[model samples]
Target: MDPFIEINAIRKGLADGEYSSAEITKFYLDRAKKLNSQLNSFISFCEEQAIEQAKNADNKIAEGSSGPITGIPLAHKDIFCTKGITTTCGSRMLENFVAPYDATVVERLNKAGAVTIGKANMDEFAMGSSNENSYFGNTSNPWDTDRVPGGSSGGSAAAVAAGMIPIATGTDTGGSIRQPAAFCGISGLKPTYGRVSRYGMIAFASSLDQAGVLGRSVADICLLLSQFGGPDVLDSTSHPIPDNWLSSNPKLNPTKPEAKITIGLPREYFDQTPNLKSVEIAMRVFENAGCILKEVSLPSTESAIPAYYIIAGAEASTNLSRYDGVRFGYRCQDPESLSDLYQRSRNEGFGKEVKRRILTGTYALSVGYYDAYYLKAQKIRRLIQQDFLEVFNKVDLILCPTSPGVAFKKGALSENPVEMYKQDIFTIPSSLAGLPAMSIPCGFQNNLPIGMQLIAPHFAERKLIEWGHYFQSLTDWHKKVPELS
Candidate 1:
């Protein structure tokens, strides 16, 4: 019943007949009840259903039919709709909305026998860098309650770090998964865009939105990915299945000599900030792993932030138009007409930050501005993708800080939208390029964790995870815990 055990350890205990799935499920539920007040992580609780699923998993295991993740506890960001679960997406607009079916990711996890604890909070419609934008309330960092847990996947990261659950799911449109993972000192991976199906997961920017895993360790994440990854006919974007990613390949030796492996450092990413302490820690880890660091130019990297804002906003503006109060989302009371209902429902339901992005997106995609703004942004996005592809020709992986710095105090960027967006500078480009990326704790500065990001080319997550695994084995940063328990 120890909440601190990693997923593998728990699985081993279950396989050894030390605990049944029912017992493991109760352990997490009790821990969640104990911690939810302080962490503000889950949006809803699925206790009865989770227990039922866990019981089924126990039966399967007794029948000698269990898989790696069978009976493991799992949580999903609210953005991924689970049938009959109140999937608010952390917005008042959908406060009472329950999905008719589960998201592909949720369905896969269910089939794997992972018990769903509940939906985790997120930025209203996944728009901000900090959890402050969530209508459900900000998720406090377990490391320091006064500081923010980076978002829009902050709740997912916080849940895992706080030990409410060992593994959770998150989506990264830009840096949603990685940034929060960095702030909370957890391991998160944003796979290449099409590596996992997105069907039934609420849309952000379709082209950029990707499903990923947030877990206590690199190994935990790898196991989750093996279960949730691969193609699904329901989602046309899902890529074809590849060889087993869980097994290491002989050709890719993560511990090879520095000259044999190249890790790129984009000068632009560094020059954007004078502080290299976070970057410095990551470099030391790479060196410790025998990686040869090379300074490479991703010249278009400077345009990433601006380009990301335009394209993501435009897509969001179009996608979010469905929540017009006429559909399944929240509706205004006593509306005189349809227009009145749409305006009031949205105005009242959306949090301030979500409203701002909607306005920004509408402006960019508006008739007169479309050609000059949205179209131009798409062009820049193409250039950004090209830059990464070109850089990959010379390097096996790219290393950078997940955030410019560590987690900030809750109110730090509340009134400043630009400053909030800047927190995503190092993360957006990878999402824009549909590249697989991860954030792993490198070290701590001022008692707060710093995350180092690793990005690999399309469908190259195996390599990225391999490199991350090697780095994590040599460093104990991932093992550090907040005194929350």
Candidate 2:
């Protein structure tokens, strides 16, 4: 069995009886278990449950009742609640927490018959740019074990890159999905805000959090996305757009004529970024494809980092208030009073980065500072959104580097929080504007993968898929898998 087998091929094999779903599931499960010690990509394995689901999928296949994703194996980010599985959100606060009900994302995927192999590790409470914030320990990049896999979706990205799974679920509160995808050399999509249901995915920043997918190729990401991307009754914020666009196989029309498509290269992005050799080479792939490339301005790009952190922290402070020791999460031992219990439990259960955000958030939302900080940040967010909207009027899509540079070594920026936040400078503006964006491996820099990001207008995921699929066809970057031993 090819560890990098495409999902469509897997589906065909299952249907033709070439290999049973059980066989594929076991193969990935064995691989994941074997590599986990070195990569620490997964927090828990659903070995028994995954095999059972695979058997059931086999039955469905035999009866000709299987759905599109039936028999496919996937790993869910720990942030998403899986019934009876530990949904840790990469924090000790929920380390022992088992969800009683499946999250909407998990529920929809299960309905499509995708087997859950395990829960991927993530930054604690989905905080931080590098996976180092994860309470379980940093998730190592498959390309370079000593370097960080971008977080909080790092584990999902690493698993796919390491060939432990063909596809996995990820969430992007800021650049969580795209950053890790860039670091680990895989395809990751962060759909427009509210494009996917977030009912059961642990809240990072309510307005910005979105569940997406990570895979070896954009086509594979689309395959898993079609199963779960759509409005859900449980999440009020979920957009009502029909998901029919995702169902179409991108491979059918591999290379759409690109002459009419206008891709904007943000002048601000290119000016600030230092190393552009790999990204420059990638732009030529587009130029050769006959796509028009124009320089556009997004002046608000510089303000994105400040605005994103403020907004995300504020929301996180509010959402995480429920994790008091008095509740179901981690509790301090033998507290004398409620206040002592709350303080000690949170201080102990939460990680250093999570605590920092909570404190910053609390201060921003405090009585005297709300308007001075939080309100101002919201106003800036509107400007950021307007900037993208303005640029969209001139260009069909926006192109930029996913990160300022390739993934850095673990703990490289540990002491410099501000420098670390800049890792997401290129990816945050899109998230703030609630637009669909993705990271595709474009080339390598110093033996590390370099990712180029594509941003489309709101609800324009189909366009992104079309262009990204075509780009993947033009280059072998997305096909370049790390030689994980």
**Candidate 2 lDDT, tens digit per residue, 1-485?**
88998898999999899999999999999999999999999999999999999999999999999988899999999999999988899999998999999999999889889999999989998898888998898899999999999888999999999999999999998899999999989999999998999999999899999999999988888888888888899999999876576755344467673547899999999998899887888899898888889999999999999988899999999999999977589999999899999999999999998888888899899999999899999999999999999999999999999999988999899888889998899989999999999999999987899999999999999889888998888889988888887
Instruction: Give the winner by lDDT.
Output: 2
lDDT agreement of model 1 with the native: 0.87
Give each model's whole-structure lDDT.
Answer: 0.87, 0.91
TM-score of predicted model 2?
0.98
For residues 377-476, write the lDDT of model 1, one tens digit per residue: 8898899889999999998999988888889999988899998898999999888899999999888888898888899988888778878887877788
Model 1 scores a TM of 0.96
The segments of candidate 1 whose C-alpha lies over 4 angstroms from its true place after superposition are 241-243, 246-259
Which portions of model 2 show Cα errors greater than 4 Å? 247-252, 257-259
